[model samples]
Target: MANTWNGSDDPVTRIHRQCRWSTSTLQMTDLESDTTSECTNRWIHIRHLPSQFNIDLLANCSEYPLFDDFCPYLPNHGLGQKTHNRSHSWYRTDSHMLELIFHRRMLEYPCLTSDPDAADAIYLPYYAGIDSIRYLYGPDVNSSFEHGLDLFQFLRHYDSSHIWGKHNGHDHFVVMARPAWDFSQPLSNDPPIWGTSFLELPEFYNLTALTLESRAWPWQEQAIPYPTSFHPPNMALLDSWVSRVRRSRRTTLMLFAGGGGVSASPNIRRSIRLECENSTSTSIGNSGYSKLCDFVDCSNGICEHDPIRFMRPMLQSSFCLQPPGDTPTRRSTFDGIVAGCIPVFFEDQAAKSQYGWHLPEEQYGEFSVFIQKEDVVFKGVRILDVLTSIPRARVRRMRESVLELIPRVMYRKHGSSLGLRNKNDAFDIAIEGTLQRIKSRLAEISVR
Candidate 1:
């Protein structure tokens, strides 16, 4: 809780609390009121804001604007404007500027950058677009990356180290991205921004039956569409969120637990039919096209789905698919867990070191099942019984554990940003702590 101890005459410490963010229930603080004589009846007052505050830009909702350069590590992408792949909704070639996204900051704090030369570089974590506002709301693609930079600039406390070019050793990496199969797509090589995808959490949430709305990063906004009355996913009118919430207010955040793709035999990178012995038919076929080919598939007959779709029926699934993307760390491993599906890995030596991020054995060991490509046939034999025999409670537990991580973790507030809160504008317990941890990690690397 916050240490806002004022004078006496305050309400009893047991007063109930309320938060604006929680969809299921409200929360309260646990503190005794100051009843001292001098402060008696002298209440520690706070102004309640109007119920409907526009959080889209965080202007009226924020107590104060963060400095532009106070925090030197965050980048100033100036509204994420770009000139590439006009078809890409996430990134646009026109009409977007990272600088103009927020109008008031520039005019109000012309001298926002206090010491631009102070910090070495900024690190912007990457996650799949599934978690970014752009994916849900549409485009701002390049702008999305820019906001990451500008947002940190808005804080003015630390600058993001997005040294994406041929830079090395100057900054720490902040991984944030989704699973993409296109090897042609460039993953930033910025310092302090390691790994490829932001889908780093265990894949438990991907397959569960829960309706999670609280786990997305930033918490303030949703990157993916939920099946709700306000933000409905498909045209499934029967599956309205309002009706679902009416039945039960508890809705778990929906996770893409995004999928990944493994390259064929090193010599056959362009092979249409994959020959992995023990892999799931996740979008491949015995004699069909691969998931990678699906995205770039041609609309007309010119682009035919060789085996009809991505996952081939004859393709076998293993415990874990160790397909790290172009930069390595393919999120498919995590996705398999969420979908109650297993992943298969074909060791690409270069990918191993590049994605040596949080491929932890402790937190994820209980769930994932890995196998070497050398023994694809025999090693994959046990997955059948092991996956089926897992208890129901174990599944639920995975859902809870992964969902709980949304707030205290990536979604946790690090500084003075207005976070996703309950109706009472409750503060998150992890914001400052998250910042400290990141700072400490950077310190460990001696990037300061």
Candidate 2:
């Protein structure tokens, strides 16, 4: 087992060590102050909620089939295909990684403080996304509203002595693993939808919520990317994988690895599939079982759900097709980026607006390709032509930009002793951005 720190080190010594390492390898030019010092100094108090709200929620893992990560590639990053000796298994459908990452990191994070009085913010570590999904498929699935009500009751009746009570929950925040659409269930007498009514509650108005996707309204909510299968245990491992990706040769112009492309639906999936099949250089791969088994040969479930199978083709392709999945944002976007492929996004809002904090603040053209959905659906504009139109040099720059953004888009190493010391992993950026927002909010309140 790695020697994980338990916040016992002297603050000055740790900060200086972090500074020395960060200045050498990582530099956040966009960040104003010293990121290592700011992140370590920002104290956060983790709320102790009942197991029902978090861990115990996944007790009956059978109901939530996605939690089943017993595949052959359990914890190997290289998916058992790569020749590299240092690799860890990662599952694409493992949405539970977000909760696991947070739970493990909070313990190791230097900012976390047991004392509420010294905390800069209160973190409500409720597994909101997972709990909601459990109810969505459980006995009282129709009455998902009850899930939100139960949480509201928990917060309203929570101990007022807690730091959350001081600011009417303004200083408190929660990290949700699912998109906001999963929790923003309608309240009216209209037909029932997919998710719970958690975000609809008045109690969550002031508190900050970090979700995989966020609605444009309610400025308190922030967008985060879905967790991917690539998790490097240390900076060396990360550097090694990145170096391999940089050296790998990419031949294909583009590729699309998705199912459910047939059935004549008006969805972009089918459109993308059609384009991929028609293109000369593009390859279409399959993984998850889809009803389009007859149209596509691989749809017979040949491509098993594994990290290598999903990302290998991506690494060989120059561009990866990213159409909206069930939600506006797809996990494939991050996968494509990590694989060093330039993502071609059909909807601008999907990646451009959703991940403002973590993604580069510059124009989307710098790192990705954007073709308006209407162009493909109505105008019949060919995806291949649009991609081919871009100059080769521009495409190269975009792919390089995507490669640089990999560390920021990826989840940090879980249970690391350094606690994002020299790396700018996704968790580090999210927490740092959240802290900055909290400080700004407190400053605004003070001035008012």
Candidate 3:
């Protein structure tokens, strides 16, 4: 469509050029010394790829599966259709549009350097999420590697300037909106199974990749927050949302809004649904247990159509049940945070081990509750009992903490300038974390 970067004399270009660092005697200490200066100065270099990798993929949205129309989500630079007639800023953002959202935000990133030689990190704006979706459920799963291999071959040309050769791409990073496991397929499978073998390729071993749900083991992947429906235009709108949720009159003790399609035996969701029904049945005259739980049966998939149907329960409940979906992570974890509801996770892989860059590891217990999946499924422990056992004072503290974490998990509206006090969003945190990680690696190589 259009050139991704503006002209050389454009405001964004001029801003970066004015603060571009001199690489003649750049030291590791200089990069690590000042965090605020690092954020304001030019450090990241965005690679210019052809439209086929990103913009053209959006143009061909109609070619995707007819059953699930993704065209509505492709507009407004992947922010999706706006929530019409709403006073607050909101959109029907697809969780898989992280690549699109990150790219749009990067266009406005102040720390971007047009000069590759002086950059600390290079961002590959490849939309692997959209590219791999067609291959995921199709019959020709074997052909899934073609587009990734092509992208790898295109980067081989960058070796002429030693861009890819410098430290073997340890300074390079890519955002894959899908789960890390979706691209971690084995090469030796007899009959081709689910997912592409993109991450398994030898060329990407040293690359620092970002995904929504990273694998638990030590690897190149890091987890970033999934895109939720709320994309506040500025800090004022964001603060308004936080205030409204904080002041909400929560009458329900816990809430669960999901489908019961899991056929696996000892299903934790089935147990949760059973407990919710039991709580509703015995609420006639029991003052202590009346209105103890709220349930929204998503088996018919109505929650996916209406955002209010999904988020209202979270706003009105003390705790939101976040059981594992097809994978360990669910978008609802971030959604609950946006609603100022304390998320009760069933597995460590859901949040604790996943989002090290965004969520604090030691402070996880302050905002969320962790109950083992086996305790609910195998031991027949009731969810209402466990949640009710938590003291009211501690629950209030946890909800306050969850409200404070709203900005870190959210992706702000593209090109919208934030107020001075409230600056860093999800994109800012990911870029900062990536740059620091690259700087650390370069320091190790310098001492070697």
Candidate 4:
């Protein structure tokens, strides 16, 4: 029998007491009183899923396609390995860990309610991102939809209260680590093009999804930031990094840290690389344009092993070149924002059409530069000439704007007890957005 004293509280009671204290502290320090009340009223209920959908996927990571050993990326509650310093909050976080990170963060969310009837929104903790990888490269492509089908089938049968059936999943949300394209595979493709048909199911139609990249139409999906290496545990550490980047001495005009042939058209990356190489010798008037650009040859996976090699160049450069890789979006866009370097995007779809929930469409010019892919690849337009033409004053303003957006794009370290006053990081913004979306949908339904 467990030890029980006459006047002592039980273990469950003690845990509840701690949770109440933590929630109260967060309410007083993190958000305004009004915001706290609003969040409290909008309670979330996380669905208790089977182990196979989440934990089992991580336990058998090696069996996943294309990865030799995937266990390293699953440590520290999906924050990956701590890089260099044990004291600092930097980790070698994989971009695909959004599902893991978001799930862990949601578990600690103050708005969580145990009573399903009182929940304003339902959270489906499915590891669709990691689960999709299993069927991506194998001959069993047709079986890619099996896991998703199984998940919804279980939900339909096991949910005694019909939580999802209440609004046809309009009030429920899921965070997908991968892009929307990976789950939107059409069933009519003769050879079955690259992705699973998870999104095509009639059951997922009304569900709200947060993904790294959303489709152009964006009916039920919203774009969220990809996880970066720096996960600050407190506002102080985040502020320190921001101050350091603001004070960084940028000597290079531009930087391209990735390799070529990542996109279907190799010419785009090739053109950018050639420009970076040729600019080393070319000079413009008085700006030391001879050292115009720096390029890191990440062809051998050096950037993955050591992020400093990729981040150092970004730190010293005024702008980071972000070309489309496979898709119109790249994780490097968020990396540039974290380093306080202005992003130079080659496609409108890369930034303008995507990330509308976090990054306002009107503010694109304030923090980033857009160069047409056609102009760079086909017209042979000089990247240096265009960048150099921008006045020093404008560049400084853009960098400042980029720095200001750092917190919104970052995922705060899970289980952080430190108080963050009046600031919402990526996770907070995502939850607020999801709740607001669900609230609005529920209100509309009530009127009918």
**Please, what is the whole-model Cα lDDT of each candidate in the order they appear?**
0.25, 0.66, 0.76, 0.78
What stretches of model 2 exceed 4 Å from their correct place? 1-41, 64-86, 89-93, 160-162, 281-305, 417-420, 446-448
Tell me the spans in candidate 1 whose CA falls farther than 4 Å from its real position: 1-328, 332-361, 371-373, 378-382, 406-448
Candidate 2, residue 254: lDDT: 75
Per-residue CA lDDT of candidate 4, range 252-338, in tens?
889888877445564778888777666645374677544688888887556764668788888888999999877888888888899
Q: Enumerate clash totals for all models, in the order shown.
A: 99, 7, 0, 0
Model 2 Cα lDDT, one tens digit per residue, 371-438 = 88888977898877687677778877887888899888988555443633577788878888888888
Model 3 lDDT per residue over 139-245, tens place:
44667655387777777764444677767788888999989999888766556577887888887887888999999773678999998888888777887888999
TM-score of each: 0.30, 0.80, 0.87, 0.88
Across residues 343-405, which tens digit of lDDT does each residue of candidate 1 receive? 334443312222222222354434333434334333433323343354545644543443332
Q: Highest TM-score, which number?
A: 4
N/CA/C clash count, model 3: 0
The TM-score that candidate 3 achieves is 0.87
Looking at model 2, report the run of 10 residues with the lowest lDDT sum.
287-296
Candidate 1 local distance difference test against the native: 0.25
* Decoy 1 TM-score against native: 0.30
Question: Worst ten-residue run, lDDT, model 4?
Answer: 1-10
